[model samples]
Target: MSKRRIYWTLQIIGWSVLIMFEYVPYVLEYGFDWDNFYNALINIVLGIILTHTYRLVIRKWNWSSLPLPSLGFRVVVSALVLGLIMALINQPLDRHTLEQNLLDQPLVFWGYVLSWWKSLLAWMLSYTVYHYLEQTRLADYEKIMLTMSMREAEAKVLRSQLNPHFTFNALNSIRALVYEDPAKAQIGITQLSNILRNSLLADRRKTVDLQEELRTVEDYLELEKVRYEDRLQYKILADPHTVYWQVPPMMLQTLVENGIKHGVAKEMGGGFVELSSEIVDDVLLIIIRNSGRLTSTESTSSESGGVGLKNTAERLSVLYGKGASFRIFQEDEKTVRSEVRVPTMSENPVISAKEIRSF
Candidate 1:
């Protein structure tokens, strides 16, 4: 039996014995008697004894996965043992009560004991039913916890996939610049190399300092600038105090890339993209905004069109569940904005020299 089942079983048996032994004899004799008083004390002593017995049983069994037949056997065995002990104590007490001028014969003592045993059986059965329901509830709770863990693992895998996909695309952009403009290509390659090194290092960590992540985005933008020339313009603003905050690596970088691809890249007249961060209440808010017309085409990939945003949402869900926020919307006709809010981390000024080198 489960510990809970065994506990309640013993409780029911003890209480049933108490109620039956004390109340029934008083009614049979039609008056109060020493036997009634003696049985009450016997019940109290027996209750304590049985409680200790129950504890020993639980300790010895390790009954996490006990079967119904085993539980039934335990119930029967415990009742038998408890009844024998009660009977032994009852024998001497009954004789003492009669010798003290109490009119009770030894002939009916067995019958009286059987009456109380039947009551105890009824109580034990009722307790078993209640405990069965409680066990079901506990089983349900464990299943829910397991399901939630599986979902979190799946989200973590998807986030892992997204980081590599974004990196490959970024490297491809640098590769295109290599042949189109050799001088700019050399600088692009160098910037890509630095970004790649930092990305590889950050991959092993769940979070990196916001300053390091911003530096990577800056390098990525610099490489893009070489390709787009005057067609792309960008700026960054950050709250000085919040610069050392920790966030998932490449989180903001992905958002910035989305802004450039979907907004700035599509504009013929050229456009400005801005990245900014601030601490609002206890939250660190990062916003990426760009100038572009509001339109959606079927050809736009989910990564840039919607996939990247979905991936970002999934990562935030894994890292912070509902505590973090991500949003994309049109601020006005000529501007589109993506904003994220995550719990702010206390500044840690001395992360690592290698981390600082990324900046």
Candidate 2:
């Protein structure tokens, strides 16, 4: 239910309870007379009006933001004023019964006001706690939404960065091949078209199928293979069961592209670039091994080197938190390996606006 509806419902129920307290006793003794009925009406009005006015004040001032000592002091002052106002309004409506006690108006007013101290304290305590919790819950919800939006925005920017860098490298490779082997360059152009099309279709998604990603990587490797001729050799090996697994879009391509640029292309005789995936105990294990000596030059190299790898790693961390890992290390003097372990999802995870509302 909406906050306004809930607030009004509580108001109605609270005032009804106050009316019942006075009306029930009067009906038991006087047998349902109009004088008692009217007196009860006055009491109900007194409770609802005074308390609701106080609610307006609380909302206007945003009392929940006040320090504890200040809020407590205000609550006490409000309750005392509310009690005095209620007593003055209620006294005239039932002065006949009240006068038999020989009480002056001042003493009578004090008695009614003091009588409300406990009830006011209870009401204010309940209201303050409820308001504070509601505000906290709303604040937490907004914070979570902001964080999710920021992560999504960051992911989009990283994915966008990958495309241009990958495109530039692919075109550069294809440019070299066009003069050396025009026939192979034609084939590379076709592959590059297919790769670009697939990336565009899946660009907005957080994840894509491993099979589709592998095809994009193959297209990239094909372009590189044309330039290197017999020097560059590569293979994509995966279990059939693992092919349909959901993974970050363009992730495998970025890794494979990095391996080709930094590893095989730099060597005298181009080396093999291998893409492999296997699932062990529900965990998807992806390994990319490429031929190169590990030079710690990844950071100061191309923007795609430091930025791309770091972007991929950060994306993995964002998607899987501590549940996923990415690492690069030298396997031998002639090979460098990148390993990724992430929880396997049968299909891409989808989140909707409605689902995000509560968070």
Candidate 3:
């Protein structure tokens, strides 16, 4: 039911019950009469009006936001006032109908006021407690939603940074081929276009299939090969079982680009970059091996490395928290290995052996 409907239902039911309790005893002591019935009806109407008015005052002043001590004081004072008003109304009625001189004895009148005060106090406290819990629940829900929105914004900003960085490097590669080999430059442009299209689509989604991401990486490698030619040799060895897994967009390509930029491009002799993936312990593990040596700075500071590496780490952190991990280290004197481990989205049938394909 709506809150307003519920409030009205409870108010009427509560006042009717309290009035019936008083009316029953009077009927037993005297007898059933219309005057007593009318008197009981008037008390019920007065109770509802007084309490409803108190509700309006509480809401108008926003008593819910008050400190506990201040709120308690207000509740106690308001309940006493309501009780005194009720007792004063009942005093004359009791004298006329039931022939009880309650006003003549100060103790009896005050006792009636105290009894109503206790009842009103209980009702007010119950109402306050219910609203307090509801406010706490709503606040917690809003906090969670705000945190999710911030994470999404941060992820978008990170993806935006990756696009420009990747595009700049791809364009530079194509530029080197334009004058030297126009035909190859044309091919490079086509590959770059395809990669850009996939990236744009990827930005609209949180994750893309592993196979699709690898295809973009392949196109990028082809474009880079147009410039480097014999200077760049690479291999992609992926397990068939892991091809359909989901991964962050452009994540693999960024890592591969990092390998060539920091590894092969700097070497006097053409260096090789190797990409591989497999499922290990229900986790998707991707490994990239490039022919290069990591300096002290790169080896020691994974989070503070090149923009690509740092951004990749942060994106992983944002998406997976502690469930995903990335690390790059020197495997040998001439090779640097970068490894990324991400949790799988679903349970898959175990493959006894890995299927590795070379490109």
lDDT of 1 by residue, 1-359 (tens): 56657666766666766666667777687876786767766676675566456545643673323787887776666665566556556655565664543245554655555554565455444555455555565566556556565755755565565566557767777877766788977887787887777767654666788899899899888877766879999999988977888888777877787777778888898798899999888899999888875566312344354457777777777666677888888899999888899885422122222311100
| lDDT, each prediction | 0.69, 0.79, 0.82
Worst 10 residues of 1 by lDDT: 350-359
Runs in model 1 with CA error above 4 Å? 1-81, 89-148, 176-186, 201-203, 297-306, 345-359
Compared with the true structure, model 2 gives a TM-score of: 0.86
Ranked by TM-score, top first: 2, 3, 1
Error of 1 at 321 (Å): 2.3
Give the CA lDDT, 0 to 100, for residue 241 in model 3.
96
All candidates in order of lDDT, best leading: 3, 2, 1
Score candidate 1 by lDDT: 0.69
Clashing pairs in 2: none
| Candidate 3 off by > 4 Å | 93-103, 296-306, 344-359
Which stretches of candidate 2 lie above 4 Å from their native place? Answer: 1-3, 93-108, 176-183, 201-203, 299-304, 344-359
Cα lDDT tens digits for candidate 3, 1-359: 66778888898899899889878998999989997899899988998898888777876787867898998899999999999998888765544543444535668778889998988888788877766666665566666667666877888888877787789889988998878888988888898998888778767877788999898999999988877889999999999999998888999899888888778988998898899999999899999999988875453265326457887887787777678899988899999999998886422222323322110
- Scored by lDDT, the top model is 3
TM-score of each: 0.63, 0.86, 0.82
